[model samples]
Target chain A: MPEKPSVRAVLLGALPFLAMCFSVPLWDRIDPIVLGMPFNFFWLVLWIPLSSLCLWMAYRVDRHRR
Target chain B: MRSSLLPIGIISAIVLLGSGIGLLAGSRRKMDLEQWTVGGRGFGLILVWLLMAGEVYTTFSFLGASGWAYSRGAPALYILAYITLGYVVSFFILPPIWEMGRKFSLQTQSDFFETRYQSKALAALVSLSSVAFLIPYLEIQIAGLGIIAQISSFDRIGRAPAMIIAVALVAAFVFAGGIRAVAWVSILKDALMIFAALAVGIGVPYIYFGGIGPMFSALAHTRPAHLVMPGATANMGHAWYISTVLLTSLGFYMWPHTFAAAFTARSAAVLRRNAIVMPLYTLSLVFIFFTGFTALLVVPGLANGDLALFTLVRKAFPNWFLGLIGGAGALTAMVPAAILLLTAATLFAKNVYRPLFAPAMSESQIARLARAMVIVLGLLTLYFAIYSSTTLVSLLLLGYAGVTQFFPGIVLGLYSNRVTKSAVFAGLLTGLLTLCFLMFSNHDPFLGINAGFFALCLNFTVTFVLIRGQKKNRLLSIPTTPRSTPK
Candidate 1:
């Protein structure tokens, strides 16, 4: 039988969709607060690498745990 | 025209040449058919993540998402919404797939079906359906590459040359390296895509409105309808948004290439990690979404929103920056094109050539056959790209609907052991026939839902009924292979 779906899994899984939900509103707020860069530009550049970092960490956790 | 020629040629040369190096590097490695096809059945977390990212985020996401945002108004957000949900769906589905792959040493999705149902015929059907759908899909990527080259060159290069050159370069790497070459090149492609998307997402709003908040507020004032939920138009509505999310979420895992990555994971945990953080890729879309809004804000009479991104890039950036962005965008198309070509080649070799022509062929012989198929498939897509009138999005969706026909065979093979080999074959045949009928007839069964979504509906229904009857007849499933401990 499949194990119970965890809260962590659910949160991680839903993050992208949730981001889609709040993206416009998030853009509205972050747009003005950039460090001389456009918020959209800052957001993706920061988030993509950051996301890559998270995936890397998750990979580590899974590997170490195994 | 001559001035732009240098930029276009430079960009194309860099991507093509870099990928060529990667191809040589891959071929030089002591790799076999298994390694080339499934990365030696033990791809580490990073490589797996990069490869999966390469497969999922294509020129389609770049062009289709932004174009949807531009043309459909509010409903365009559904592109982001559905893709995010799709990864979430993958988290649950992939674990068992990984375990199954490990236990059986499965190389392809159809191999899984073949073993589970004990049916070579069902495996053949899945392979045939996948190759058929994937060819058109590969053509769409080639088409997208041609479009970017055309736009970036500012018409300095003709369309036919662009298509031929792009196809030839992709075939070169794919024929040389296989999965290793694709994975390495994808990292570069992803970086460029993220950078370019970030540039467009932020640059347009910042230059146009001083900031994003003010940008939206400006849009709100000019066309508040576009600003609000359900968007700025009467045609876009809540139903379309919700249904698109539903369709894409379920259909995401249906693609053969996505499953092809499963056989490569070093561990089941890698698959989970990929699913957990994959959503962050959606961050790239925020800018694409903003770019769509930028179209609404700045470009008037914008019937085509996809052009909004390229137009903004050409208008704002210097030649060097535009050249870099064009190279990056071209990489987005090229990386996927390599993978698709490789995958179609593998499918043809394993399912078609091996069974029909070389029944006693060794692994190396099969690998050689796969390489030959890749070259042939690449040429075919090049021909179609040059001659066909089909737009990128249309060709993509047509391929998608056809591929999604495999959903039933895939799902039942994993979840229920009771699905008979004959029952599974019948279901697949019926599903494929129904999908082809609806697609060719232009009769979308699920009110405004795409053809793929409609086919998934029929595929699941028939598969469910067939499995239920098989179970009643005591045609129980053979037990799945025991899960192996991760090395």
Candidate 2:
């Protein structure tokens, strides 16, 4: 519909998903607490905001293409 | 149980207030079947957000999330993983599905199948399975309500009566207001739930162990592995975690209610924008997990994992605050129950009944039958909620396994015209039969992968092979356009 979304846009859209699903090995550690939260829990909490940003960026790119 | 009357009274008042708001929303507008089912396709960004969030964060998430965190530990993170990925998947899938819905004036998820594949039998199959899957989902909400009422009232009221009262209230509001009622009530439910979660999650750790850091430190000192994956259990390792997450995320929008919610959006852009923002709602879930972790330290040795969150709240908070949280939890249960019954009833009436038994039925006749079915389904769910004793999370997972089988059918229909109608139908049946066989025989993790994942694989293979065979026959070649006209 919007000229097959750019590969860059598609990759940007998938960043959060890949980061959360595949990077389990990287962020599954419990050491080095961040702001009173466990490192593992903190990683998830951080991505909540970061994923929103990724989606927003993808949305912007798609909107511009349209 | 210190004279729980004050809190019980507060909870009753809150329930009444929510029902009153629901009833008032229905009074101003006249609803046809379309209006009743999807709000005449008039919802904008905010209403869609509240409705989507409302459906996603059910009572199961309210209590079961913390319950999983308290009991299973690291495996509980799967809840967060699946939900975020669900939004990511929605960004790619929902806009096209929403476009199809608008083009066909589709009211239910089953309607899409019927119109897309040009087969009534396929539509009926989808409708039947969706309704069957939705029953357990509804039962969990009804069960959650019973638990909240029992705990908040200090077991003075008992679970059955609490559930019956909830059933009556939900049935009444849904019969009067439909989707609009559910959406408006969600706004209030979302607000109250956020407040309650924040109060319990942050308040419990700070009050008991000085802060979140100390609480985790103490947990690590006592149960070091609890802070990591495989958690308190031995079986849920990396493989189990990845497969389960993938299965549930793919299955997220496959829920009939979630699929139907897309049709309510004002535009495709609204649906897309909502997908981007809906991940923020998972933040509330993080707070719920905090309370669950806190509960592990405060209320140890609970017989049932489902009771963990309530046990912690009753032990830690005052009567007034407990009542407030109970109110939030009750709304959480009721809101989603309303939407489930609405969607299931619509599927039965429009997709199953009208096409099979009463093809000549008028629009008003169908609407009347759907409303009646709502009451019937509500009563059936109430009976199961009172009688069944499974954990909420487990019940939800079983439902997910069944519904996720729809994934291949839906995706292929949207993107590929080469997939024959017969192949889609056969694929769904094969997937469902495999799922039932694996689950009933208690071989859920057959070959160390989730049964649902395996079932999906079998389903796709069958579909692919059948489609290739059909191409050789050259039998009624389907149009290769992205969207085809209805037969």
Candidate 3:
């Protein structure tokens, strides 16, 4: 049987948007550079893998529901 | 200036190699419509990954991406944001779409629309608009080809003639039944693209301003605003950035070609895992951004930003290295063009022509017409490329604004059967007209938000308001009734 995405999964989906989009203004400044890249640019790159991790966790949650 | 044979030579050789592998891979199978269109819907996870990766690394990413970084600065990172967002959204939509495709024996995206809403007319509207939007997209690939050839060959070869020959060559090979084999060629294209991007990304910055870190530090000292939102432009601030990201990410998979590519997967499980892993592809784009940044610092005043990468490569790298980069860029342009041409033509032949014009047309006739449409569409896009050589990024954004009008209908239809076909039809017409007005009237960033996003909001509102007014309420839309199109 099919099921809608769980709250946890949907919220987990939101984490990427939160980090990448919503929090953009907060991290938009290029100060205190991390790992040699600007804070602003580095912040988004940092989220790529983190977003995958979030989605993977979401997938697991989705699978458990199924 | 005299042209060099080396870059053109390398481009020709790689394109030939791509077509060769495309032919070899598909030589074993008969070229039926199903196989021609969706690779028999049998692509496993790895093949789907390659094909999806092919979809990602288009001429837009290859050249236009770096161009944006060169011109726009931090605003270019929206490309990075929206792609990851697309994969996030796809994880939910694709599995369901896949199940529907499997159950209905659906071949194209328009078929999905038709089956869902129980209306051939809706499907025809979809086919018409999607093909219309795809033309500008296909234009960039052809235009990108011309640009790469012109820059790499030192302008000895004009853009128009080069695009004509290259597209004709690819269409001929694809017409001969090598569509599926293009996946194998993608492996080469992706590898070379990554290599070119990394080599330039790391090498250019390092050569001029030390390392990547030092490069940014240098830029911060020289042009501080280029590292943040709005970047070089005053208007494209955080709000503009967020709106564009939302607009594009939602629209990414909505492109008819990308939607069809998702259908090529063997199973829903494959698609779920694909979404989990696909964000990794965006990391390669960061390197492309680095190349563009370095170009901004090193050679600051090229008339066209899209030429940044090619211009830098010509100045910095050896002749053969320039050839290698150009070859990879050529494949990046052509591979995606192959799929777009195929998708648009298939939509035209199967969904539009077969149903609306000739309801009694057989599958074989549809297949034959699709093949002929490929040649016609290729020439048509070539003409557009020659006529208006807009910046690659704007062409895509304009196209995105149009195709993304489908999102309300598709996503809503997935969750509920309550949306009436007339409502979606009305909503699409409204969204397209709003975009046309906003874009043409120079109000694209109306009140600092993306005009496309605004139109999308209006579309949703129209669709929802109209849905409430429908008397029939929820239609059963039973999945078991496959290939049953009620007139």
Give the count of colliding residue pairs in each prediction: 4, 0, 0
Report the C-alpha lDDT of model 1 over B284-371, residue by residue, as the tens digit.
8777777777766677676666677777777777777777878887888888888888888888898777876777988888888898
What candidate 2 gets wrong by more than 4 Å, as runs, is: A1-6, B391-395, B472-487
Question: How displaced is residue B439 in candidate 3, in Å?
Answer: 1.3
lDDT of 2 by residue, B1-487 (tens): 3989988998998888888888877778897898899989999999999999889999879988998999999889989888988898888788888878888889898988887788889988999989888988999898889889999989887989989998898888889889999999898899999899888888999989998889988887888798788899877777777788889899999999999999999998898799889999899898899888888888888877888888888988899888999999999999999999999888888888999899999999999999999999999998898888655446566679889999999988877767778898898899999988888787878777788988988999999999888755654443233343322
The 0-to-1 C-alpha lDDT of every candidate, in the order given, reads 0.71, 0.86, 0.84
Candidate 3 residue lDDT tens string, B88-127: 9888888878877887888888988898888888888888
Ranking by lDDT: 2, 3, 1
Winner on TM-score between 1 and 3 is 3
Query: Which residue pairs show collisions in model 2?
Result: none
In Å, residue B471's CA in model 2 sits off its true spot by: 1.7
Model 3's lDDT to the true fold?
Answer: 0.84
DockQ versus reference, model 1:
0.17
lDDT of 3 by residue, A1-66 (tens): 124577888899998998998778899888989988888888889999999999899999878544
